[model samples]
Target: MPGPAARDAQASGSPLIDTHGRVHRDLRISLTDRCSLRCTYCMPEQGNEWLARTSILGLDEIERVARVAAASGITTFRLTGGEPLLRTDIVEVVRRLAAVSGPDGPVQIAMTTNGIRLREVLPQLIDAGLSRLNISLDTLRRDRFRDLTRRDRLDEVLDGIAAARDCGLRPLKINAVAMRGVNDDEIVDLVEFAIAHDAQMRFIEQMPLDAGHTWDRSRMVTRDEILAALSARFTLTPVPGRGGAPAEKWALEGGPHTVGVIASVTAPFCGDCDRLRLTADGQLRNCLFSTTEYDLLPILRAGEGDDAIDAMLRSCVHGKLPGHAINDPAFLQPARGMNAIGG
Candidate 1:
């Protein structure tokens, strides 16, 4: 039987439905395909090509697409990037998206950032209607952080986390990518750090989204391995009703603090996924691993109205595969890395 949330979603008359009967309500918008750090798991340390400034969508173009999405029943807009905080006009972006209204109400605004520049812009962002935050921090050790991201900005990230907490961003999520020989040893320690900061710690299993296409399955950490490492330190009580959210959450020791794992590889959750991604260059992606993308910039620039965008969105969702198919024998990594695709 469908739960109340599912039943309600079905009754909402949303057009963002796939052939598999999934109703899409979440949209991940990538502001830019540029980042300050080059995480080994995400991009190459050098020789990475970025989109031309003219090819990237402008603020007005982004808002128009978002407005169409909101009218089509998308309720939440998560702003991402190579690093969203890197965008100079991010606060204005939030202000614009927050003003967009859906059937339910004004759209919910959220962001996923590296946290290096968070402290400088968080106050302005909050004032501009930013509601939720997720900061990426892989390792607690400074030297390891430098090696993992090829940047010595761990202290800046930590300060950003503290600033976010002080600003009252409850359930402030700290995202860490789990790797086999790299930061896997810090899984339990990362969770403990989240507890100390009153934040929810989420560990994401590294996917084959690297710009260099050098991802090795043997070197990737699995969800079971992450859970096993945590179990040795604290009691984890599974939190039920994950719905469409990516992370599988667990309450630590049956209390307030909790930890989550986004097992994209080991335990795929494509059946209930409601996310639709809009790349910084105005490409619409059905799945993170999708090789196919529908370019929206030309249409928008060509003076096509909302009807055109709405049709494109429906067309994209209609073609959504049953799952990401990462486990398939024929699975191929996306041509663009996570930075370009939007994390």
Candidate 2:
């Protein structure tokens, strides 16, 4: 039997839990691999897994993982999925995660959803301790939305966004992927929608990490492009994410709210990459674009114990490269998409 890695043991009062000096302040755990729709950027339109019905992390597993993650340093956690709402007992999972208070401090509970089923479950989720929402909505045009997601029910998503606002997930965030020549035209529209809703919007640059890598850099919508487009009509002032973050943020000129830009391709933000992903099956991934991951469940489930799990995660984070070189021509996206990887 393989002995547990030395980094797994958490000393009595050691505030640091992982190798990256990361206190584990934030965690994004995937709930399922099945999604109702496959956005081009996230997965293929057809010939993909639909009945990918795996036994999602049981509620007890989620709770246990949260406890382990918190003990190591993660103070905030977000639940994601092929579409998290597709899970059978997501509300219960949120309830459990929300109940966690890390040694670093209280954990901030959040979720990243597609917004299709949000309307039906918004109230339940908010009541379960969901504090913030990051809804993926690339285009505002009804036709374009249907074309992009291959689903005609744009109204459902729109309604879901409204319901989330009504439920008071204050300052809801709208995340948009800036695809060249496709939804790029809707940047201004998305901005206006956020301003109208008093929500914070994020325009993310499509990365090479997608199956949609056949993109044209000529049409690549850089953060500068978006700022310029919005600046023509509204002045944008800078408001960086969390801690002088990479997502270049700006408030619209004369607009009531601000927007954020995620440029992972044209510009890679790997150095300050404080993000890590935990897949539905219990693999902790240090970088979304990296091919490496440390399997915690197999060992822990095999009875290696909590200290072992903690040390394993520490070695994983320590082995984590400064930042992934995803934009390089040599870069090839992992066979798995965002959904499979726990977007």
lDDT (CA) per prediction: 0.91, 0.75
Residue pairs in collision within model 1: none
Worst 10 residues of 1 by lDDT: 5-14
lDDT of 2 by residue, 74-93 (tens): 77788898889988898998
Q: Positional deviation of 140 in candidate 1, in angstroms? A: 0.8
Candidate 1's residue-wise lDDT over 1-343, tens digit each? 9787544433323558887989899999999999999999899888999999998998999999999999879999999989988888899999999999998999999999989888899999999999999999999999999998999988899999999989997769999999888899899889989998999999999999999999999998999999999999999999999999999999999988999999999999999999999999999999999999998988999998777888788779878999988989999899999999998
lDDT for model 1 comes to: 0.91
Model 1, position 14, has a per-residue lDDT of 59
Model 1: CA > 4 A from native: 1-13
Per-residue error at 322 for model 2, in Å?
A: 1.0
